[model samples]
Target chain A: MAVEKFLVEASHIMMFARSVGDANQIYYDADYAKTTEPGTIIAPPTFAQSSAQFDPDYFLRPKIGEPWFGSGKEPTGIKRESSGGGGGGGGGLHAEQHFEYHRHLHPGDVLSATVKPGKTWEKESKRAGKLVFSESITEYRDQHGELVITARGVGVRTERPVDSK
Target chain B: MALKASNLRVGDTHSVCIVEDLKRTQIVQYAGSSGDYNPLHTDEIFTVKVAGYPSVFAHGMLTMGMTGRMLTDYVGDGRLTKYGVRFTNQVWPGDTLQATTTVEEVADGIVKLKVETTNQNGVSVLSGYAEARVD
Candidate 1:
């Protein structure tokens, strides 16, 4: 598969700041950020993860090949048994998130992000049954070709009937 | 200039910082500004019907920002060496986030700390660790 590259614009930064209810003068007010410790209104560390502007269908859309799969949802890529059989339901659960910041990303700082598959494997679960674990890492770079941020996240997925009760 | 490994112990914990209760409007404004239209975070009905959430919730990044505030307070300017975190759970409006830090290991002027944020119910909303260097 070809790697998809995306550009994160300044407006996105403002929007992320708004979504998080971050009223910090640094993020919204340029003057404040310039005077602040980071020396610029820098993006909140987790802001990049919340952008949600990626092509969700490609990597995140659930049950790509399953007929009974629902819309707006994607399989967590986690399966129960080593033979790929089921144990308990619920496709996947959030496992962990890790972020590293090199420099403060400010307004008007265009960021280019390239996401790639990091790892995939299976694990035995005591309660939720067997699980599939997938991880992806997205690296963001500024227009100046400087590293801005790096994020690695894991999603635990399983094959189970949708919960109705 | 170097933070010795003995500087931080496993049991060393910092004072807790209590964030003021954020309003629904603040969350909504964030939705409009950030472009993260995940209904689970901005729309009450969508949250209940689709995501099974109680109500509109704050963005995870918002909670992370609060953690950043804690760092700024501790290290001051030009002193922060390295910072990182992992998002563990969701944070809803009206939820108060309390952040606490504990020294884990300090070696060669670098301080490693475990950081966490929890809600009033004592449920951990975000759990992760961080490392910083002091000048």
Candidate 2:
């Protein structure tokens, strides 16, 4: 797991919400949100985790040579070193997500996230046989050094991705 | 209506969010905003030909976030203690999604909910739950 920090802002919060096609005004309208108990715009659930792009070293960063969603039919030419046996290469898919809110997040909250490895399990799957799953938990705290939210996500990796064709 | 923990009861239902229809560009927008460059969600050529899927699909997070609108809308900002989702199916373009929640438990000023989001076809795409302290 990788640890990185970020300063949450109203604009970023609004963008993430809008990007998801969310119509909640509290996420975008500070004036409207001010009328609410929170008194300021707040991020929607999993906003910090979904905004991992702001943190470069995020644990869930796509592997260097792994297959990306937008790539061609050809396999990525990147090679994983043979030194690793148990841990496979960089290709994996997001399997599940969890978020625990310790407190509300508002604009101007300087959040720092520490991504840690969580539970690992193996199961037989009809789609991908003997699938391996790993969890990554990212904890976000505010500027006052208080926990705001803990985001737990799962990634499933297959030795070779399934062929839909 | 904001639901207080005291008011929670099993079978209490909350109508949350309705994604009238999904748009391909919306998925692209989400990927751009979230900084996820996964082509499987947006690259039709890559997804259909390279990945062997019938078509590109929505990002799981995109669906999760949309489903989360139910909790956030009901409880408002910062009231939710925990929320999570399990991806169950592919959400394709032209699909309509509705997120709904049911009160499963209530005690100690904490409310537990059984959350579900399904497409127009009545097929569940995401399922999970949440816990929030009601005031």
Candidate 3:
């Protein structure tokens, strides 16, 4: 489903930049950014808005209870294996990610990010037993209703359930 | 400043960027603001003992975000049409990452770029490309 999200404040961009612990003057001093090469403060690449996973109404979120990574009811289709480590396979891993920007994002851009279900599959793994792979595709449109960014992410989970040892 | 779209050719090159070293505390702050509390990244004990890893590591997105810094610093407010990277390796504390971009193509007012990020050992942590409007 396509959902809309507001930037809330231009400061969100700065906060994200600071959170990353990057003291790049451009992300901070607005006047410096204004006089510099780009001539304006702009969101860093992979800015907070580029992530649909952060959206409260994202698709992976089940309508019922607290958000969980695996299936809500039970794990059925996922292959199960009890082998030990060797293939770097693990229950929890962020396998891959990609982001495409149609335009730069400014603070306060009311962006709508629509997360559409993407291709998912399973493969064998040596370390984590079996690995399930999935992607959630999202498109971000700015306040003017122009597509500004497209984000794609790959999620990987181990066949074994998360446990404490 | 980003080069004019017209000035970008397939072989045009942007200088390399050396990012600040990753500190221990930034990991926690990032988790707080980004709302991603993956223990593998934030909890030292979890990473070393629970996860059976050597030590706590920075999020790939954090490195990717620093790579994003390279893009923004170079393009200066230019629009990025596409930016993506595969997390090839982990960035440990005290590792200083660096990245560089090359113009791959220019057409229809779009400048295509290839970006690569590497660690102090010259080991690649992430690699990808991006397209942005510079004209």
Candidate 4:
């Protein structure tokens, strides 16, 4: 399976920067940012993960019959037909997320992020039935092609009876 | 005043910093900028009816940004080597958020801080920890 990639522009970054009330010249004032911060104009710390305009239907929404939803939603009956559901039906749950910043991101630094599965393991939940835990890693790179940030997010999919109480 | 790593001990606390009367405009700005249109954060009707929240709330990242600003204000830029947080609760408009930081660990040019934000009633809104590299 191939992981999808997305591109984000400076406008998106600036929008999030403004939303956070970040007055740092680096985010808005390009000249000021260049002069103030060592990099082009350092992006606010949380900016990278913030203003993402991903199409949930394609990028985030899980494939039909995948036996799980993306973050918090329950599994629907739709099936991919292409990718086979491994076993009993269940759903996915968001577990945790971690991010590592290499250096400050700046305006005009086109960013490309790729999200892919990092790891998966099986576990049993007393309440939710059999669960498959997985981690997705999204790596971001700047226009200069440097690794700016790396984010790893964990999710759990359960294979429990839907009507089980 | 610079915060010295050696001066900070486990259980050491900082003065309460209050951000008075957060407004809806700030929340809107955060939503517009962050692309997080999770109505629980912006649309009042949606938040109330769908999410069952009392009112529109601020984005978790916005609250974290405020905390980051506080750390930067105290320690200066480029000094925050490692910062991380977990969103524990939500914050609504007109609420005054009081922030506090407690030194949890210090070693090798790094100081671990347990940061928390609370509402007027002293109920915690956000609680997490961060580590900063101090000179």
Best DockQ among the predictions, by candidate number = 2
How high is the CA lDDT of each candidate model? 0.59, 0.74, 0.67, 0.60
lDDT of 3 at A48: 48
DockQ of candidate 2? Answer: 0.50
* TM-score to native of every candidate shown: 0.67, 0.86, 0.75, 0.66
> Which candidate tops lDDT?
2
Candidate 2 C-alpha lDDT tens digits along A1-165: 443558788888888998877787888898898788777888888787655676775443465765433444453323434432111133466779988888878887877778789899988766555678899888787888888888889987654444321
The DockQ-based CAPRI class assigned to model 1 is: acceptable
Ranking by TM-score: 2, 3, 1, 4
TM-score of chain A of 1: 0.65
lDDT per residue, candidate 1, A67-108, as tens digits?
A: 422213542223323434232122344466677767656667
Model 3 docking category:
acceptable
Model with the higher lDDT, candidate 3 or 4: 3
Better of 1 and 4 by DockQ: 1
Pairs of colliding residues, candidate 2: A69-B38, A69-B39, A69-B40, A70-B39
lDDT of 3: 0.67
What is the per-residue lDDT of model 3 for residues A78-151, given as tens digits with 9 covering 90 to 100?
23244543122233566688987666776667777777889999997554568778888878888888988788
The candidate, 2 or 4, that scores higher on TM-score is 2
**Candidate 3 on B4-39: residue-level lDDT in tens?**
776666887665555567787887666655656555
Which candidate, 1 or 3, has the higher TM-score?
Answer: 3
